[model samples]
Target: PTTTQAGRAKPNILVTGTPGTGKTTTSSLLAEATQLRHINVGDLVKEKGLHDGWDEELQCHILNEDLVCDELEDMMEEGGNIVDYHGCDFFPERWFDCVVVLQTDNSILYDRLSSRGYTGSKLTNNIECEIFQVLLEEAKASYREDIVMALQSDSLDDISRNLSTLTGWVNNWILDRSS
Candidate 1:
């Protein structure tokens, strides 16, 4: 989609939530349907070696927030990128036209995480984070309330509904900006 303002031809969408909340899944479908580039932050961190070092305990890399933003700033400004990550506060608030935080029921989340082999502290921390709606609250705090929304990802039906609703919204945004 093209924007009225030159050099702003696309919209940046951030799809974020606690782990196992389906941010990647939703963003993937959205990208396919909307023709946006899907950038999984985790994959980016790994590919670009943007991480500081490995976290043996958490079993994940320690990402450098500054480096990540620097590396992605250009694409973000050019727009039409759907960013999928569990955390959002570190990203510049202005980078996104919309921030979607997917939510899942605790039991459903537990099952999903368990199936992924998340155990003990890691699993518990993630579940607690979901229960507390940390990602949703963070999105709201980082961006205008109108631009940040909490979407349910509890089932396939919910995912379908979300995709339809969000695709419509994206279309409207493009039309509005272009006009």
Candidate 2:
């Protein structure tokens, strides 16, 4: 039976996008509006040491994918996790009711990432990833067609619109659960 049939229930939503996209901002806003747990996978990985070691080339931690998955299994099973991550396809599709892939203009993404001091192949690759809409394609390929949403996040207005839209969805979902 559904969690509603028993007692409490919450839906899991995945907010993913390229590094320079607004995944963190949008997800954080969404979390605040809905009062659901916002799990930043990158922070979790760092906090839990769910990684092999630092990637000297990438200038980031080398994630132990399995360990990350193991650590998140409980949250995934529990059902209220709003996961914020750069990669989305690795997550179990069933763990999410909705997968939001945020998009941004490559030029804007480039400037945003550059402001953060990203350069070389690291920066180039990310800009390219955003330009190609890789994350959106990945989400669509990995999840149910109806559940995958491609949202633009190039401006503050876009972010606010997205936050409002997602906030409404969460409200309706929770209301449905209670009913």
Candidate 3:
């Protein structure tokens, strides 16, 4: 959707990926550099009690998608938000101007998840999710292909490069909206 339709001067971006793929770090830094609000959906779910219940197998909250969407609707309509989440299919497509799916190499992702104490089915499922590009595909299916991008997130350099690319995009978005 166009910024004009939302009456927004800035854009809303969704940064998503498999767990340990740097969605939080990238979105946090991007928000700091671009002055956009960073909404970590996981954190939001916990903070707002917007969940059905805990998922015993997943070791995470069973997010109440409707509640989460309702909570975010107004801010999203106003734009200038960098939403960090692992899954994308549940979010409303119109909430974002750009969708970034960060990908990390399988081995690196394994190590990262391992260090984070992820084990058994949780770790195995996440690794498989990355290997299969689940999140990237979900984003593409959920949003316009032109607005969805997959960026590397295996190292600090990659994160820096992504930040630069996204910062430039943000500038262009503003210019395009203004003109």
Worst 10 residues of 1 by lDDT: 1-10
TM-score of each: 0.95, 0.93, 0.96
lDDT of 3 by residue, 1-179 (tens): 54453588899999999999999999999998999999999999999999999999999999999999999998998888999999999988777889999999999999999999999999999999999999999999999999999999999999999999999999899889897
For candidate 2, the per-residue lDDT at 6 reads 24
Candidate 3 Cα errors over 4 Å, as ranges: 1-6
lDDT of 1: 0.91
Rank by TM-score (best first): 3, 1, 2
Per-residue C-alpha lDDT of model 1 across residues 1-179, encoded as one tens digit per residue: 43332356778899999999999999999999999999999999999999999999999999999999999988887889999999999998778888999999999999999999999999999999999999998998889999888899999999999999999998988887787
Model 1 misplacement above 4 A: 1-7
CA lDDT scores, all candidates in order? 0.91, 0.87, 0.93
Which pairs clash inside model 3?
Answer: none
Candidate 2 lDDT over 1-179, as tens digits, reads 43331243888999999997988888888888888899999999999999999999989999888898889877777777799999987876678888999999888998999999999999998988987889988988999989888899999999889999898887887888786
After superposition, the stretches of candidate 2 with alpha carbons farther than 4 Å from their true spots are 1-8
Ranking by lDDT: 3, 1, 2
Pairs of colliding residues, candidate 1:
none
